[model samples]
Target: MPRAKRFYIPGCVWHITHRCHKKEFLLKFARDRNRWLDLLFRAKQKYGLEVLNYIVTSNHIHLLVSDNGNRDTIPKSMQLIAGQTAQEYNIRKKRRGAYWEDRYHATAIQVDTHLASCLIYIDMNMVRTGVVSHPSEWRWSGYNEIQNPKKRYAILNYRRLMELLGCESLDALKEVHGQWIEDSLKKGKPAREKKWSRGIAVGSREYIENIQTKLGVKAIHRKIHESKDSSELREDQSPYTAIFGTENERLRQENTYRWGLF
Candidate 1:
């Protein structure tokens, strides 16, 4: 099947994840994690994106970011970043072939609630996975930036989240952050499914409806009737390969005589 186009628009936040092929342990050491972080920083600087939260697990990575680039450009930027990281990793480890799956998966966070949920989801990923007891214990994320005043990572902007939460003081922001963590502990139960545990935004109906409206479409469900002779419905050839070939051939014929008319 042809890959679907990635959706990336300005002012949009995405919960993005990419796993190693076959879920292998790609990031087995500190150097591996550091390389991933370096790639993320370079990507942010080059693409003019804000990395809200991120976690580099042993096999996969999660990113919550906002891009200032034009909507269509974000996917290209992400592809470039992922490709760069995968190339470096493969080369350094003396590996071959593709490092990641076909593409990174992204889910649009539509509302503030969804964003909040996604943020909590990302921060608590390590906690839910038994990698750490608390989010602050996870060394790969911005939790250190949140809890430590002197510590700083250029990609993390705690003030931005404070502003988003409408908190005027850092103290207030810290309090809010604490409360959020507490509430999340109560509400954000351990995710049984791996995908959801890896920062997938479980959105509400309203959020989904908004997505449909933004995409300019309505999703309809259809029931598949069972048939014994399923082979009859199968296509021997893909039509996508020839969708524009006829027009291209006509244009080629039209141009051939012009070049040879002399």
Candidate 2:
């Protein structure tokens, strides 16, 4: 079956997720996590990848970045980071085979509330998994860096993030970010699982439809019936329900290489 072409709209913020092969704890140790972060730093230097937020969990990773309208930058950065991380990990562990389960899932995020929601989602991933009580407790995530500017890690581009969030100063951005995260926690809004990881793009209805039109794909229809499973859809008003068709359906019907994620 042909793969779906990845949508790379310039100036869009993307939430990317990639899991370890077989969902194994490939990055179980702190050193391995640091290694991945090192490679990400290198990718930033080499390709100018504007990383906004990130969290390196034991089995998977989530990254928020702005494409700046460059189609090749994200793919190239991912290739370099994932390829080097896997190669070094294999050499050290004396293991061989696929390290990543599949190509990373990239979902375009609207610049408004959706971006903020996605950031909170990524930040609170560890908390949702019972790994930490708060996102600040996770050392490998952007929460600590954003909350404490003296972390001395140049992973997140604070100025750019603030710009995107429409904040004139770092202090203002941090205030709003902290308040939002606190409110979400108090309301128990952090999802145990995210539908953003499963969809093509997430934003306002108009924004998603525009992307569909630009990609020359059929518009996604809302699910007529909701499933009872927790892993299924939720009542969130966000336009995250618009999936870019299933991979098998795309392969059979479009016969094109632009298949969505597995």
Which candidate leads the pack in TM-score?
A: 2
TM-score of 1: 0.73
Per-residue C-alpha lDDT of model 1 across residues 105-218, encoded as one tens digit per residue: 765564465566667778888888887777888787756556554344476555566656567877786777677888777765567433333222335545444443433211
Alpha-carbon runs more than 4 Å astray in model 2: 1-3, 150-153, 217-262
**Which ten contiguous residues of candidate 1 have the minimum total lDDT?**
253-262
Single out the weakest 10-residue window by summed lDDT for candidate 2.
225-234
lDDT of 2 by residue, 209-241 (tens): 555555443333422122232111112233432
TM-score of each: 0.73, 0.82
Clash count, one per candidate: 0, 8
The residue-level lDDT of candidate 1 at 201 comes to 30
Candidate 1 lDDT score relative to the true structure: 0.60
| Candidate 1 segments whose C-alpha is farther than 4 A from its true place | 149-153, 186-189, 192-202, 217-262
203 in model 2: Cα distance from truth in Å?
A: 1.0
